[model samples]
Target chain A: MDAAARLFSERGYHGTSMQHLGQALGLQRGSLYAHIGSKEELLFDVVNQGAERFLGMARHAASSGEPAAARLRALLVGHVSTAAQHLEASTVFLNEWRYLSPVPRAQIQAKRDLYETVVRRIISDGVAAGEFDPGVNVAMAGRLVLSAGNWIYTWYHPDGALSASAIGAELFDLILNGLAKEGPA
Target chain B: MDAAARLFSERGYHGTSMQHLGQALGLQRGSLYAHIGSKEELLFDVVNQGAERFLGMARHAASSGEPAAARLRALLVGHVSTAAQHLEASTVFLNEWRYLSPVPRAQIQAKRDLYETVVRRIISDGVAAGEFDPGVNVAMAGRLVLSAGNWIYTWYHPDGALSASAIGAELFDLILNGLAKEGPA
Candidate 1:
């Protein structure tokens, strides 16, 4: 699975062939087919695993019973950590999932939408509790958070200066406090 | 070029073939070869065009003689608008540029680095002028800005509720002001 994820990330889903998978695994075509159904199956498995990881983190954070801000922080941290730890899978998940056929594609899309909804709900809760600015655009705020979190897969390295959690925390701080010295004005 | 960009974006650089490009353009292989050298050339052309659009926008913003915040806003808006307007090319540029051969790859990387530097300089200037929070992590903040801007190509549509500029402006407001009601806590 890891090898498959790596190839998919490097060569793209359509570009990676079953023959290539066999070579990567050091298996003959017959042996490879004995274990896996098709290239699409591998693609689906890799993409599905990634969706689950993201959705799992979001779900855990949503149910953590923490305040909205804390919950959001946890969610972002978990998300970045997952992407950093599973870099190849995350890359394939983020970039190649669109190639999934209709049924599986819809399944992944549902999970993705659910994840966004969870993030938005956290922001909405923050707004309702007066913890976040009442004037906040919940949807846009949610997109910004997800965007920052999602793009980490492109640049993050485990051996880099910052850990995944630290990256998430810094982003969380920026999202909550902003860049302006006076905050807004 | 448009057909090539669309194919490259949809099928990926490695997955797309000369035959596919020829078919998309309603040209025979001979005619396709008459107009283009190879798949790599098309890839480089598309990626380079996208890079120029992005760098052009950032350079324009950087040289605007405006305050850091205003410059940053113009940069973000221009970045988002470019991505939204050239969705197919932007998608290929962001996702498939890595498939370029080493020399062209380095050229793209250089432009990308310059773009990041431009963004970071805006934030650094803001901090130096006391317009932004002195505690801001300029690198992370720049990544956050670029991440938000880059990810728009995945979801933006010409017929969407908000125009590209409006979406960029809303994100600019969020990035500058934050979500916390009382700011930074």
Candidate 2:
């Protein structure tokens, strides 16, 4: 899966073939079929892997029993961590999503939307509970959160100065508090 | 420019050729080259043109006589509006940026960094002025704001129910005040 994902991401899904995967795994193109049913299956598996990881993280974070504000932070942090942890698979989930068959693609999109729905609900609850700004727009807020979390695959490097955790922490503060100057809490 | 930009963005950079641009414009490839140097030049020109628009908008917004919050609002709103006004060019800027030559790429990147740096400074000032959360991480705050702003291109539709102004306003509140319920202002 790793070899397939790396090649597919670098070369693009259409450009990758079974022979390439076989070479990466020290097998002939025909031999790969024994282990993996089809190219689309490989893509489906990789994408689902990442999607499951995200949904799992969201579920775990939701059950953490934190305040709504803290829960939202946990979701953001967990998401970036998952993206970093499964960089290859997550990259496929994010970038190669178009190559999936409609059934699988819609399934993945639904899960992605579900995660955002949870985030939106959290923000809405936070607002009602006075843990968030009253003016929060749930739709834009969810998309904004998803955007920051999703784009890390484009720029983050393992050896960069900021660890994923640190970056997530910084992002959490920025999103939760904003950059406005204010008196000390 | 819009026609060229649309082609460059919809088709991959290398996938787009002078011949195709000519076909779009109803000219021979040779005639297209007379007006344009090469495919790379076209890309660079489109990217530079879009960057200039964004840079102009940001500079104008930041340097305006409005209050800090209002200026930031205008900056964010103007960007979304400009991107919508020049959707094809903006999409090309976000997606096909890599095809630019070294010098042009660096220039655009520098301008991009400057825009981000300016936003960070504004956020820092806003935090300092007690109009925002003091604990905000200005750099990451800038990234969230910018990324959230740019992602509008991915999903926003001209005929969509939500206007650009509404998105900007909602996003500004999300980034500045957060989802936390407002205490007394």
Candidate 3:
């Protein structure tokens, strides 16, 4: 699975072939076929695994029983950490999932939408509790937060100056406090 | 060019072939060769055009002479608008540019890095001018802003509820005011 993730991440799903997967796994075509039903199955498994990881973290954050602000921070931090720890799978999940057939793709999409809903609900809770700005657009706020979190896989390096948690903390601060000096003009 | 953009965006650079390009353009392979050198050339052209569009908007925003807050808003708006307007090209540019051979890939990378630098410089100037919070991490702030901006191409629809400019304004406001009502914890 790690080898599959690596190949899918390095070369897109369409670009990676069963032959490539077999080579990466050091298995003959016969053996590879015995292990996995098909290339799409492997792709589905990899993408599904990634979706589960993200959804698992998000669910944990959502049910943490913290205030909205704290929950949001935890959510963002967990998102960044998950992507950093599983960079290859994250890349495949973000970039190559579209290659899945309609049924599996819909399954992944549902999970993704649910994850977004989790983020949105946090912001909605924040607004309702007076913990967030009254005028905040919950939907857009959720998208922006996910956008920042989802994009980390594209550029994050394990050896980079900032750890995943530090990067997530900084992003959370920016999202929570903003860049404006005196608030909105 | 439109056909190439659409095909590249749909099938990805590696997944696309000269044959597909010729078929899309209703030209024979021989005739297609008369007009272009190779499939890579078309990919490079499409990706390069997308990079140039993004850079053009970012440069315009960077040089707008507005205060940091306003300039940042303009930058985000322009980024969203460009991606929304050139959806297929933007898709290819963002996702398939990595498939370019080393030289062309480096060219696109430089432009992307330069665009990120433009974003960073805007935040830095804003901080120095007292329009933005002094404690901001300029780099991470820039990434957050760009992340929200760049990810738009993935889901933006022309007929969506909000126009590109409207979405950009909302995102800009979120980045400026944040979701927290009482500011950072």
Candidate 4:
């Protein structure tokens, strides 16, 4: 999967083939087919797995008993950590999913929208709870958070000055303070 | 340039060719070359023009006599508006620059880095002026702001609920309030 993710990330989904995947894996093309259903299926698996990791974390965070602020913080941490851990898959998920066939593409989009909904709910809750600026655009705030988390795949490096945890914490601090800025603690 | 940008955005840079671009513009392959030097040159032009717009705004904001917070707000508005106005060009700039030959790629990378440095300077200034949390990571905070602005190209729609100005304003409000949350106005 990692090898496939790297290839897809580097060469793009349309540019990659079953034969290429087979070559990377050092398996015969015929043997590769026996093991993996098809190239599209492999793409679906990679994209679906990446989406699931994110959605699962979002669900857990949203379902938590904590306050909206803490819940949002947890969501950021989960998002950053997951992307950092699966950087290549996350890159493929972000960049290559556009090439997925109609059915799988819609499925992935739905899953993505679901994750976004959870983020929106957290912001809305914060606004309602008087923990965030009432004037805050809930949709925009949600997108901002997702953008911040999603884009880490582009720049987050393992050997960089900050660990993934530290990066997540910094993002949380920036966002939490921003949303809660005009509100009373 | 617009034609090239749309083509590149829809098709991966590698997947696109002079024939594809020429067809999109209703030009013969030979005629296209007569008008435009080469596909790489077009890519560089598209990417360079986009970067220049972004960097121009960042430089202006950075050099302004306004307070760091206000300058940052202006920068967001500029970044978001430019991105919304030229979504395809911005998308190509962000996603397709990777396919540039090494020399042009480095040139683009340098411009991008320069834009980032301006953003970082703004954050550092805000911190120094006690207008933002002193503990803020300048580099990370800058990236957060850029991510929020850069990713606008991905989801921004001209006929969406918000106008480009409104969207920019919302982003500014989010970043401003977030960064200045702990600071006294």
Clashing pairs in 3: none
Better of 3 and 4 by TM-score: 3
**The candidate that achieves the highest DockQ relative to the unseen native structure:** 1
Worst 10 residues of 4 chain A by lDDT: A176-185
Leading candidate by lDDT: 1
**Tens digits of per-residue lDDT for model 3, B38-134:** 8889889999999999999889888978888888899999999999999999999988888889999999999999999999999999999998889
Q: Place model 1 in a CAPRI quality band.
A: high
Instruction: For candidate 3, report its TM-score.
Output: 0.98
TM-score of each: 0.99, 0.84, 0.98, 0.92
Per-residue lDDT over A1-185 for candidate 1, one digit per residue giving the tens place of the 0 to 100 score? 89899999988887798899999989998999999998888999999999999998889999888899999999999999999999999999999999988999999999999999999999999999989999999999999999999999889988899999999999999999999998756
Lowest summed lDDT across 10 adjacent residues in model 1 chain A is found at A176-185
DockQ of each: 0.85, 0.43, 0.77, 0.44
What C-alpha lDDT, on a 0 to 100 scale, does residue B1 get in candidate 1?
76
| Candidate 1 local lDDT, B16-103, one digit each (tens) | 8899998988999999999988889989999999999999989999999999999999999999999999999999999999888899
Per-residue CA lDDT of model 4 for A38-111, tens digit only, reads 88888889999999999999999999978888899899999999999999899888888887889999999999
DockQ of 2: 0.43
lDDT of 2 by residue, B32-97 (tens): 878888777888889889888998999898887666778888888888888888888998887677
CA deviation > 4 Å runs, candidate 2: A7-44, A99-104, A128-130, A181-185, B14-35, B99-103, B127-134, B182-185
Q: Candidate 4 lDDT, tens digit per residue, B1-185? A: 98998988887777788989888889899999889888889999999999998898889878889988788888988888899888999999988787788999999999999998888888888888877766677887788898999888778988898888788878777776752223222
Clashing residue pairs in candidate 4, if any?
A178-B178
- Model 3 misplaced regions, further than 4 Å: none
